[model samples]
Target: MDVRAAACRVEAPASRPLDGTVVRASGDSVAVRVAASRLRALGCAIRTGGAPLPPDAPAGLLRVERAPWISGGHALPECRIGWSGPVAVPMAGERDVQAACGIMHVHGRATGGPRALRVDYASVCAGVLAAQAVTAGMLALLRGGTAVRAATSVAQAAALALTQYVAVATTDPGSGSSRPEPGAERTPPFRSAGGVRFEIETFRAESWLRFWTGLGAERSAIAAGWPPFQQRFATATCTLPPGLQAVAAAWDYPAVRRAAQAAGVGIVAVSDAGTPLPPPPASPWRLRPLPTAQATEEAPAPDGRPRTGDGPLAGIRVVESANRVQGPLSGHVLGLLGADVVRLEPPGGDPMRGVPPMAGEVSARFLALNRGKGAVEADLKSRAGRETALRLAASSDVFLQNWAPGRAARFALDAADLVAVQPRLVYAYAGGWAEVLPAPQPMGTDYLVQAHTGVAALLSPPGRPPAPTLMTITDVLGALISAEGVVAGLLGAGRTGAGVRVETALADAGRLLRDTHEVGDRTADATAPVVSDLAAMAADPAYAALFETDGAAVYSRAPWTFTRPSDHRREEP
Candidate 1:
């Protein structure tokens, strides 16, 4: 699909003034056009034909455009770039970016062939990052900072998508051994005797055991499959015992589903391209302003030190209690925008913090999303722990969480609970299925949500069985949307002097990706050699500067670059 056509389909809310900023888009790249669309959706007036503003115009004027490449204080002309595919065009297309950044490598590892996502994944990501940069710039201006120029490339965005994988590849000695051998029995999208292909999910080992046992699988096979299945999220590869597949294939889908339900496991049949699913939310998130009468005034900095930074959220404080990729990544993005984020962990800290591939004292995957954040250990189930969280929220600008459904409310750490104590807070909930699916929702993990929403089908190559991309597509995109929503909520709160509630879901993220355009045969070259080695890719001078190395760990730099006029000046990326 043409990048611009696909970008035009991205849904954004009606325009509303975000401090009456005059945003403009002048480049023809997909990233530039989509950022303009998003800014317009956020209600910034787009300046198409206006008198050129004075070079020193106030901070409200913002521009978002694309560049061929941005690295080491230099941006090559769009026409001079020549690594991805065809050089005849001004910029590389999405497929070239995907192949170059190792996205296809990770995405196709389990699917038997490397292919770009049917959706314009990289361009859309870059566009969203661009929009986020603009929003952060606006926030910086509102917070009494100078105007800023931000730039991002599709390659940078693609590299950001591979951050977790890169972290593991660079830090873990045993990472390479986790890859599935050719023709090995893979996991999930299991086919039943009736020929129904589906995905199943359960975080608890006991539940997994029960689900498999209910399907009459041998005890040893069930045990053998559990570890790989559970670790798939972190490792992006699942090699299961053949007996498990045999057991699943012995029964019809109804029987398989019945066993799943009896075992408290979540199950969803892989959807087809023509399946009738609920439409995605008009916008990726729902933001509602709470009554101002109950709102608390913004808290003053405890140390009384003035915040100073080029990033938009210089002094904002965020309290995040989230487990996996979606929620933690949201906080990470906020941190990238200059927020001071403090993680709320359990008494022993998050268990994932110890999951393999250690970078210093923390898991490389965990650090990928949590690198500059502070941590506080608290048990939210206890009254004292709840009070600790409440106190943190009382002094914070945003409280972000992605606990399982009702888990927050059960512990009285829900949005309502937090907003009551901190009425000026932006309460952001990154959830799964968020009233979109019917009662009895499937597990809200990335793969299952993809299956339930037909994203697995949409991303699968032609003639291949529906398979979820192993790259955690929805989790990452959902994080982007979550951060964007939080920023929007913060802006609304700034305008209305009230707390704002922002809710987003994995289901919505999947829906957005799937429904963005009609599925077609557009895919990257499946026959091309898969470039799965991110560490090697990072070492190449073409992308080396986009990553930073600490000890043995490698981390992708922030995708967007922000600079003030005094620091440097550039009209394009």
Candidate 2:
């Protein structure tokens, strides 16, 4: 209940060093103080800019503190942070909050979904990332007295929620378009005979095949494609209309559970019984310091974008050699905070580049994360490619990769190799699971992590099979976590001139969801309205602006703003 760790006593340092100023403006000084305390916990020697707080300042960074879910789950660090200045932004109020929610709402309307799902979808995801941002900023400060600022808008958070399927470009060339196929959006729930609900997921092609084989059902029982609701019937046969029939209705929960276990597929029961899921087992983030080898800090900067800007990570360089969502998204976050990121691809380019919904040769999803980044081509298997990659590593402050376990070292691209090239580099790695094994599994994926880590079990609604949360929730979370670790490493290197290795996995990200103790966990909100009329929301001028279209594509305004001195101009260095 005490999200601020108010009862925990943090001894102040005997003497404080003069650091940068933090300009904070929020009606809730308590929330501001909480954020300040987090920064101080990181050992930041910051002073609040001594200025008057603006009257109509938008939520700014402090909105993260006010997020309903922040105070729950894992407790905040214990140090008390102090500030001296007032903040600005004359045009912010409740309207801003509604406007932000409204923007995501409009996006949902464009995609077609229920209003309730729209309202909280972005907020929940944003809240998670917001909390991570605060923690990451603190981590950076703790590593060194770096003046790091994390500013994210509700809209940005909303956009992140959509990352799972947005422009889910298909690899199948015959599909003719990059848009996701119908029914690919969600894995539907099926009702059991006793009116209970449950769900199952197959992250890989082999999974559902195993499910059918385990049930001793004909292979034909499996759907031709990855439809979320193919198993709506309880009959062992696959010949049933989805969404109309309660397939599991023929079996009880235990029977269904047995069948899924026999198949070796992941499954969970749905509950509308209003029981909240348990909190995460451990803290969402774990930062461990690793031993470092002494070396000169003269690593050559990689050839890529000339980062010309000012922010927490200004002048920092990042080399990204990962693909799909997690690695690129982490690089994307670093870019947002003013890091110069260079994305490495093979001769043909990233596999994601070929996905459909293309503006040109690249997919929108690729553009979303890869924009503002420098790009290069390399063949990691080739001697020349390895040398090129090494050069890039030698010339960078950070290097991130999501290659399968042991694959990096095989390619001579692991942390040890890179650290040898750039000793002060912050090397980050993302993976599918946390545990290291002698042998690698087939592949780690977001869906599998959700099922394995009890995320599906917790999200299961009453009377329905267990279901996954948003597609790739753990994937995105893992990326954010990895990004935080990278920043922390960078700050640490800044202070001690020692390189560090940061690692995160999709499997570990599932723990963040578990750790999230919902705000006022309850079955019902007596004060809340039953439903919101989309039409009424669309009628408002401010809300309507959110739906504005630019030709065939719809455009949105940035949901949040940063007032950092370094944010003044974005130019190529």
Candidate 3:
């Protein structure tokens, strides 16, 4: 189907602002054009080839087109991109809004395994970059009160989408036995207690033992009945024989909650959230650019490049007090630009640093997202730590966190609280679900978001159980969205010299996944299934061209490249 036709089939909410340009094309072009459509909406002027900016075009113009290259062990169609001002483009858009989004489960040698879902990660990455560019452009406009020219290519956006899955590392200790057996399928681990079924994820053997003990049940009975591979789900059934019945008979959600809370275990009642979800912007993810304050000041980078700092975000200071992959990834990407990012961790450091697949004290996941950022050790719970963080916030352009609902307020890190101190700071939050949902305060994770938002259901095959996307898909998207909001908010602040609050919820991202894929009778137009799995995706000449090798390892090429460095002048509006 043609890209324009596919876009027409997209069902957007009536209230969604018609803010961006929408381009239509087909076939290989769909991938890039879909992302380009999003960038245009974020306040960018698209250009093709190595073309010079039009005389009338505004400053910070992005010249986007295409090229081809080979490096390392892989090849890819080069999505060459350049920015006029300090950075490329602002990053902002709903994950589900991009047309022709192709999601698939690929099983090939490139996947490193049969079950790995390694679809077009490069495209995902490119989409993320586009969001960043547009966000930056939006910020510049908010600051200078002028529109900036933003550009990107179809191939680059496609490559970015695919980057999320590449070289991903998980802490799950390869405990495959807990996965249900084919013929012995059972209800989800949600067991009925007091006539209510709740999802109790004890994926790990240790967590299973903890739940069992917390319920005052016999470990011996559990050990005797279930094998290593089945222990996680053995308790998932509705009925347990006499020997193993405490969890159901004696324990209710409240009782389990108390014990689990005390023991730091995981449990939640099954939510009834189904499709036809609330309209777009379903998540708390928000972008509010404050009015540029009078006498607003932007500190210069140590290696000064531009008065607005350097690179797109040059001197912007970001304090990232987030844990795990989702929130950190946002800050990491900002650092990749020109932002001065300072990651605040507890004195003991983020627990993720100690997760498996570690190299010394930090894990690959930590290093991957936290790269190019400074670190600070401060416990938010302590008064001294709070004060120190407040100081940091006061000096930063953005403050990002992923604490549970209201936790930030309790800790005096909430937007309202921080805005009092840093009136120009872009306060951002990324979480699992939206606060509007019934279970607003429930502990949310990538898996829980998948399970709760029906993503698992959609991914599930005909008769099998619901399955989650291969990686922390929602988390990554949420992080990227949140980051984009921060930049856009900052841009607005630069203009009005006022701060704004930005939010992105995993639930909202999940909703995007559902909406984009749940088009009734319009699936064919929204996406055309690609048979290429991980190996095929890896070997595809187009996909291969996207990768660049540094002799040691092959990875997705960075989106921004300097063609010829020179001072960029702004055009009069």
Error of 3 at 525 (Å): 16
- The ten-residue window of minimal lDDT in model 3 covers 67-76
Score candidate 3 by TM-score against the native. Answer: 0.63
Model 1 poorest 10 in a row by lDDT? 74-83
Q: Which digits, one per residue and each the tens of the lDDT, describe model 1 over residues 1-573?
A: 322122223322222325344556554445545566667666666655344433222111235333211122221111111123111222346666676677777776664555577776776667677778777765554444555666566666777777888999888745634357655597787999999998999999999998988788999989888988888887677888888888899999999999999999998898986577676454556777654425323333334235554466888889999988999999998998888899999999999899888898889999898999999999999999999999998888899999887788799887778877777788899988887687767778898888878888877658988888777988988888889888887766654556778889888777666655452224434333346677877676766657887776888887766666564444442
* Whole-model lDDT, model 1: 0.71
TM for candidate 1 is 0.85
Candidate 2 overall lDDT versus native: 0.49
Residue range 432-488, candidate 3, lDDT tens digits: 766435653456776567666776666544575454443456776667667766766
What do the candidate models score in CA lDDT, each in turn?
0.71, 0.49, 0.49
In model 2, what lDDT does residue 403 have?
Answer: 89
lDDT digits (tens) for residues 112-200 of candidate 2: 43222212233334444443455444333332223234454434554444432332211122211212345433334556677765556
* Model 2: residues with Cα > 4 Å off, grouped in runs: 1-151, 163-223, 227-286, 289-292, 295-307, 435-443, 460-465, 520-560, 565-573
The order of the candidates by lDDT, greatest first, is 1, 3, 2
lDDT computed for candidate 3: 0.49
